[model samples]
Target chain A: MGEIWPLFPAAIFLSFFFLLVLIELFTISLTKTNVFPTLEPAVEILKNGEFHNALLNTLAFVAIGTPLELFAGLFAALLVYNSYWGKSFVRTIFVIPFAFPGLVIATLLFILFDSQGGFANHLFQGQYWLFPKIIDHDVAWRGSKYLALSVSMLGKVWRDMPISMLIILSGLNSIEPELIDAAKTMGAGFRVRLQRIILPLIFPAMTTVLLLRSVEMWKEFIFPYILAGNYPLLGTLIEKLYGFGSDPGEAAVVALVLVGLTILTLVVIVEITGRIKRVLVNSGVNSK
Target chain B: MSYIDRDEIGKRIVWAICVIVMIIGIIAPIYLLIKYSISDPSTMNTGGRPIPLWPNRPTFDIFLYLFRDREFWGVVSNSAIIATLTVLLTSLLSIPAGYVLARYNFPLKRFFLILLISVRLFPDISSVIPIATFFVRANLHSSFISVVLAHTLLSLPYVIFMATTAFEFVPKDIEEQARVIGANRVTIFTRILVPMVFPSLIAGAIYTFLLSWDEFIFAHFLLDTGGQIQTLTLYLNKNLSFSPPQNVLAAISVCLSVPVMVFTFVVQRYMVSGVVSGAVK
Candidate 1:
């Protein structure tokens, strides 16, 4: 027992890894239906197939969301890069949404878009009237799968774009003024200077933020759970399996898929961003 | 100053428009939340426009209701306790581990760093079932300690990840100087190393605090009984039934967001740099 005491921490670490592996095995082996009959029919639900779909959804979401955020963020950062009157305040306001809890952000959208008394209906019709007679006639936001997905995307963008902006802003700050001055001396215009200098130098920072944000958006649960309602994002699918009560087999299957897709996404990001030589050269030029 | 420079003005104008659109898109909903929180509940329920640009019949009733409600206070206290404890415990475990990772040449060090980063990327949902099961078996569900431990799991990796950078930034020469001055390793760490890395530590603490305070999944999954261990987010989710008074809910949301907002505002300058530094390799 005394000798075993020394091995306790290692044992705990091993157990944690064991639990993760066990979840992966269960997720891969079981039929989704047999694992979670209440959530979905066992006959049509192939664990392997659903796993693939979730992987696809995760990849698609990341692919769509990350570049979108980066472009938007970089544009905003460049716009605000040169100090202007009230720029600090503008930066502060931009960051407010990020400070609000994800659940609050989701609920705010839900309140704004939920087919009943939603602000979207009012805005679309250009009326300030509350409880407009036309709200019920509008399609429910959560009822339509595509609309639900769009709203999820919008909510996520609103919350996360500021994060990307902040990252790019710092990267912008680190670029030395002499480079800009040298470019201006060379008769390069604004677009040329940006394309030739700023873009290359900031690419590494941009890629890092992109990878982080992609991982975050892929794993996101709260916004989709609230805004998407019953639409089956990977996060929600896992939740449904767990909610069905003691369906460890199916839940494990979902978990394994989640982990595998996350690793794949990470690997892809590393590969794409691995070519840092161009960025390093640009950074060196700016430093000099 | 010349006609040729008019192009610059045009560019600035375009930039202004873009910035305004981005700000409006991000800030409008949050502004509406604040507006709704202050709007009269009666006006809200009566289907009135309720002053879109300004508060009409603004009242402190919502804030009063939140303060007076036992459930609200209970959840706030629970959130505070859990968040604070999670930050404390996460730092305790992570700082030493981070120091080791930053300074040591241990075997599997690179692998461990990769593992930590990957774990951060792994979705919380993936581990929910097994962790939940473990909690149930241990009979720790709905307990404050359980939630704190759960939050620690979510927070520890980031703390270590951030702190490693923070520790690495402290110049080795300074530590060597301290040692030459007869300061012990512990003294050098507390007196020199900690003060230098204080900003990163604070940023890490704030991040962990916010993460725990806003966490909903584990709190929802683990806490079953009312009044047992309801964090603020859990309370908000639980109260999101049909016809929850918008003003009251908004008030609660405002209350929940204020600390983070204030923290961000206070550290506004350092926060951005700190985050970018920690995250962007």
Candidate 2:
């Protein structure tokens, strides 16, 4: 129905220009190692002890952060949705964290919880004296290796909770009020209404949020770099390899692996999304 | 009547508690920056640390220091220039391409869609090194333009995808009616289609600009032209190493984020709707 000429050039550009990235990936990875894009890099990484720590750190991040973000977002949405007055202002406040740059969040939170004379230490200074040896004094959360990693994970959760709430809130809003009323009329308790009516309706939204969060966490470098000092995630590892190690091949290997993981997850989401739409439509029809 | 009144009271209490918790959780962290940005320098690193919760001697000296610093202004200008160019170029490229995807049936369209989606999957960290090397060889590295182009690569896919959705929402009949009235394709697109999708256009531009603004990895490698070409993110990381004065760092952090927070507050609904359409729906 539309002219082909103008759009054709854009398509060709899409096809061609994107290849430059792929070609660059292949050529750079091979030129240095004289091996395949991932082969030597994978072998070297597996041999390195930090690789396991990075992998474990990444998994811990996703496992702890994803659920915490989702639960907090869901509860926040439910509260806002159920509230009466000033809904718009509440939504505005909910989104404030999304506005912060990653470095800003990491740095500010670091200062907020600084070990000596920081907020946590000052607030808990009384508790420390009252319960000596039982109450551990506010340790430098971002200094210890494991604790630093966990605090950075908390930072990710804090910032990302807003977008997740927004997405889930929209989905929750789309559901018919009549459906929930019907459940209540059927003598369903509050938990039953939520479990039977709300959760299924919002599953697709959760999937979208979770997938986006996972992809983001996979490439999460800035927070860890800013908050955790010398801690290495897969992302910071890429930086160290290229900038410090001067091994673009190894860095390419790490980068491509992350890409591979992301693409694989995305493919699964695509397959599931088709079924989800069908399920929602069929459920609505069957109920009628 | 009594039961309903009690139920209403319970719900109000829950809402009140939720608001309180959210305000404390989100605001308290930001308050840290405000606290340190005005903390007295004498109380920092020299003698016993002042109570960070409440700075006894608060002053705006740090803000004055950064404002006077030449390098801070350079990073600020660099960020503004790159983010501005990114918004303009992303819109120019994405709108037409999105319209095409929405209106026309082209061969390999699904293939192209998947290809575009695949671009989003790959992190910039993965490809930035190779891209940087390629750009350097072409003598394009270490410049504001290089950073803009690199950011566009990350921004374009999301913009194009969102733009396609935005175009689809503009009722087909409006465009069809325009076509029947002797309007050519360009006129119809620019005047009719563009106006209808204006909110989405704004949202897409905001997203693209923010994406470029916050991106640090690509800026790190691509704009390696000494200290002059660094973005705000690079500036922060560069200063982070020196263990710069806490108040100065806090001021820098606040400077980088206040604009973003203001933008988010203004366009909150548009952002939420855009995500719903693009991500879930």
Candidate 3:
């Protein structure tokens, strides 16, 4: 104990702030509507139509964005899995999107998807001779709720691709070359090798990607805040409640809900992945 | 007879397509951003013509304008000050704690470790209001002190993790040798252990600096009332809310991002591990 006094500083700093935040969140949220403790704040926010919409939007964001991000990362890792000339340079380039701040990426998307004369709109309208016209008129990227949220998801997924890529790339690199070589020697096709060997081996990395990316998607605030101001995901909803609505109680309630959803998603992912692993193992035994 | 392996040909073809797609998908947006920054009015507001891929007359007017702007410089300096202070604060708190954790087997060590990592589980957006409210109530809101503290809290876990790994890498024999030479604990910690772990600590510091520099949610809430304090992120957000000219926005975005981009390339190796560590453990 005498020798461990050095740990006190960091321990106190973290624990102090940690308790302060939890206490503050709970106190304000419960005491908002009554002098005594109550669940009114939670009830009020939960019953609101806006909260429901935001909840659904957040669910959709996590559902679509997490899997898409994992696939994007897996795609990138597979692309560079084989050694080639300029491989290091290509890998560095893949990280460029993530190197930029989230806010910067969202702002760039805002400009590019600007309803009128934006580059994307111009391209789709066939202003460029290199590609045929896909749409005759300009499409408003943020004109509707779906379109707005889609733009936000696009920005979120684009900016975060590198995180998943790095995780999965490391996973891919861990695969012993001898395994692949043996598969090739046995006349296993590329598709079979991928389906049977590589995919199963990289399952852990994919699980990591899913876990981390889902949490990120749930807490995504900047993209939707910037790109789809009219539409509120649960994250941006917290900002809106406190910033514009000036209701800290409601905001705290939403924040708590966001945290709950994140934990739930994590649990569900773990269980699902565990079940799949068991099924895969059982099938392999049956086939043998 | 001419025969080719279809699998070999198929792999090459797919790889080629992927390389092209990856290059264009990543590079095109960045190109547009730069073009927008330097673009002249005619190129931006073509009024109905297809906007040219390249700017009609590229100029440095926006960059020059920003360089000469006092407010822009203020925001830049504010971000620098807060980020520097965060790195300092986080290092001071994390190094001793990390060293202790790496070397000692204290009671409740497992609990402390879990507590440290789980501190990061709270979403920044959710946590910001409470932190901001506390600061405001304490009359520290809008001050650099509160923002720096919040940033340190946010980045401490990663730095601590990095520092622990760093200290663990320094063999225990060196410390034992120092003790045998009659050196005390403090002397060995400062003269031997710290020096050996200095490079990794610097890596941790760089990571902390970037985290603080790129932080927004906490800063936004803490500095919300004080119109005087603006980080680069807030400056960009404010400009965007009011519909600034495309070039000015792009220039500001470029300025804000250049430091992060530069450090990223330099510390890419450390960053890969730092990123994974933050998520996995």
Q: For each candidate, what's the DockQ?
A: 0.35, 0.47, 0.71
Worst 10 residues of 1 chain A by lDDT: A2-11
TM-score of 3: 0.96
Give the B-chain TM-score of model 3.
Answer: 0.92
Candidate number of the best lDDT: 3
- Model 2: per-residue Cα lDDT over A40-69, one tens digit each: 665776687776777677767766776788
Stretch of 10 with least lDDT, candidate 2 chain A? A127-136
Clashing pairs in 1: A27-A252, A27-A253, A33-A42
Question: What's the TM-score of each model vs. the native?
Answer: 0.83, 0.87, 0.96
Off by over 4 Å in 2: A8-13, A31-39, A124-138, A264-288, B1-8, B42-54, B171-183, B225-227, B266-281
Per-residue lDDT of B25 in model 1: 77
Residue by residue across B48-142, what tens digits does model 3's lDDT show? 78888999999999999999999999999999999999999999999999999999997789989998868889899988878988998998989
Best by DockQ: 3
- Model 2 chain B scores worst on lDDT over the 10 consecutive residues at B272-281
lDDT of 1 by residue, B1-281 (tens): 88778977877788778777777777778888887788774545535342355566878888897899998898899999999999988777777666666666655666666666555455787776666667776888778887887788788777888888887876677778778889997798788777777778888898888899988888877785343678888777766655486776677778888888877765554554433333222
Off by over 4 Å in 1: A1-60, A128-139, A269-288, B46-51, B171-183, B224-227, B268-281
